[model samples]
Target: MSAVSESISRRVTLGYIASHYGFELEPRFADGVTVTSVADTPDSVRPGALYVLRDDEEPSWLSVAVSRGAYAVLVPPSMAASARSAGVPALLATPDKATLGALAADIAGTPANTMAVFVVCGVEDDEIQADVVRVADFLHMLGNPVGIVSASGSSSLERELDMSYPLGILDIQHLLAVCSEDGAAAMVISADSQTLRPGALEGVNVDVLGTIEQLDRGGSQRAFKETRQRYGFSIDEQKRLVTCTEESGWLAGQASASRDLQSQRRLSLAIAMAMDAGVRRSNIRNALRVSKEMR
Candidate 1:
């Protein structure tokens, strides 16, 4: 898996929010590799890897996390100070509001897309920290998930951290679900399921539907074009329907109205099938009612 994907699999990670305003950094060396490491101090550093910093008194990890072309560094204020003094450009201190905003901007390279880094260890006075809220908001706005480690030592958090990397065992079920039947639809709907509308259903598998539409709008005048172009319909049968409908234009209009009714029936049938597949009857019923109105 790619480094970004791998990084995403981990629930809680340690990285700093760099302050952009203070310093201009130039790469001292290019490691030409990607590594994943977790360390308590500078010695835990790998030249080309992403490192997670463990809480330590010395703050040596801060220097290493930011140095040698590292992706980011995580440190408390005391350690961040020392790292800054040592010329670590991308250092971020815990629980600092103004600093996190400045640091988030630096990491993302744009003011709008503030990315978040989840810290495995809890910050001091996290209960009242506005920076944590900002971090959550920033991640949320970007539709990114950031899992921070709390001092509570919650097992849930620990499980999340272990599986946050790409293709981790914990994420396999999600991956499989996305790759299954209606998987493409599942992906689109699941991503923004709360906001999905019937109109947006066409977007669920846009590439597939778009190709069908392109075939319908052929250069030559062809019969049965619309039906053949629609999803889940075949060309010959579509042609026959069109031919029959055209033979009786007046009756075809009435038939068109009936066709809509039939489509609603089919949709209702689909909902019933879903209900049979273990969806709650109420949900299926509501969905069918909503689909009818949408139609």
Candidate 2:
């Protein structure tokens, strides 16, 4: 089995979840019951998993999850009575997307806390992918194992990113845990507006944030200045690379040139993010040289 699979196999007890997230437990005795996985649909429930029922779901599905040997259930307040009478460990909570994310992260051991997590957002899908690739390549060249999670897919330098859950808090946290288990020192997550919604990133630690400049693409006038001022770096449009105003000459010619404006902007943002993560100037220069030679 892969490292992530191995990590997923690790179990957590209902009591731990309740205590960690401050959820009210029904029938107090179910605390000792262990859950190996979490599922939203009854069809996905395993023998020792916890099934979270949404408010929109039919009440009858609760029995279905119980029949499938779900060790525990996290249900909406309205279902508390039904869950209590179902003869299993029950947790009373909102069961919203954010709540599920927090639960999933807890179950996965909250791995994002273990390494530097860089976030890339506010850009197109292709640009996000390009930025992620650049960041991952730079980190890997510096001898730090890195993991990547993008809208297209998830991967790590050491192995393929395998996940059974959908791309939400659960899948993302699980992937981060897997990367941590596989010894990744850092990770890059490509997030769009959907993924940036209120509860999407719950329990994950984001160390740095970067956004591609879209000034000429009808972006807000304050976008470029705000990002540069906040992050201390900006794209030098004339040179097609990043300029770190805080550390003059830090990345002079270390960035690889790109003709496409979008690619250049993404590349510049990626380099700036790497700099924020404290990558040494010498390492950046060497990584750039190595990347150029390989192209």
Candidate 3:
């Protein structure tokens, strides 16, 4: 197991998290404090686990919880000073939840950085699903074990991928954290991207999907070509691929005669995405026919 997988398996120390945030730990709760996980609700608290609390939450309850078994507390923003004064044993403080998540993952050593991180950023909801299928399928075919960070909403793709993550806990920080995970192939979808911060993953090469060229960049053509060469994609298949490569191309073609394929339980969304991108359904069927699953 990797550092991240191992981290998840074992408990981490409060000093570890504080070190990542560059915060000095109070001597009282400084060393020998180990946490199992980041607790969401107080009821799920485990011995030596960290939990973040809002300023408005009941401090008495938090105090009581810590007294019982909680490892450490991260006071939100201004409350940290106050929390410290109140003897909360606040190990670290941060206003931004995203920042907190990033710091925590940094201490714990996330495994996403080692994987292929793909994001379908800066697009509308309608345009996202089709692109997700294309890019994810492309990664799947490249012999990577795909782990999808499904940002809620889309039901079909969520059900289709066995290893899927719910969008509720996924933020930019979470995405960045996951990007560090080893042996990971991730795809994230978002409806809006106008204000996406500059230099956000600037140096990183993410296969941003949603356009025809983007589709090809994400390995749609590669998968298609490999499939075609192995069997044979004739003129009809070639024509189909051309027609559907662009969002406008396929959206317009699929507009009049729309097929709601959610009804088919066994059908992989990867196949749907390929077909939506203009690979002939027959060609996809052929590719699957020669594969172990189809056999």
Best by lDDT: 2
Model 3 residue 191 CA deviation in Å: 5.5
* All candidates: TM-score: 0.24, 0.76, 0.52
- Alpha carbon lDDT of residue 29, candidate 3? 53
Per-residue error for 47 in candidate 3, Å, reads: 3.3
Q: Model 2, poorest ten-residue lDDT window?
A: 232-241
In model 1, state the lDDT of residue 111.
13
Model 2, 1-295: lDDT tens digits are 1111223546888888888888888877878888887777787677887888868888778889899878888887778888877778789888555556666776777788788887665556566666777667667777788998865557865687654422555556667877787888998876653333334566675677666544342353355444333322223333222222333223424454555555545455666777867787677677767777887
lDDT of 3 by residue, 1-295 (tens): 0111223424666676667566656654565676665544465455565666655677655665576456677665555565565554566455354454454454444433444444443225334455554556554553445545444332222243222222222233334344433345454343222313322222222333233223444365564444333221122342222223333343333322325433121124344344543456555544544453433
Candidate RMSDs in order: 19.4, 6.5, 11.7
Put down candidate 1 lDDT per residue, 1-295, tens digits, no spaces.
1122222222222222122233222222322222232222354344433333435455554555557444444455445556555453333334232333232222222211121112101113332122233222322222333332222211121132232221211122222222231112111011111211112111011111011011233421342333223211112222221111122233223223355543333233223223222346455344434534555
- TM-score for candidate 3, please give it: 0.52
Segments in model 3 whose C-alpha atoms lie over 4 Å from true places: 1-11, 60-69, 76-88, 95-98, 152-184, 188-295
Candidate achieving the largest TM-score: 2
Clashes of each: 11, 0, 11
Summed over model 3, clashes come to 11
Global fold similarity of model 1 (TM-score): 0.24
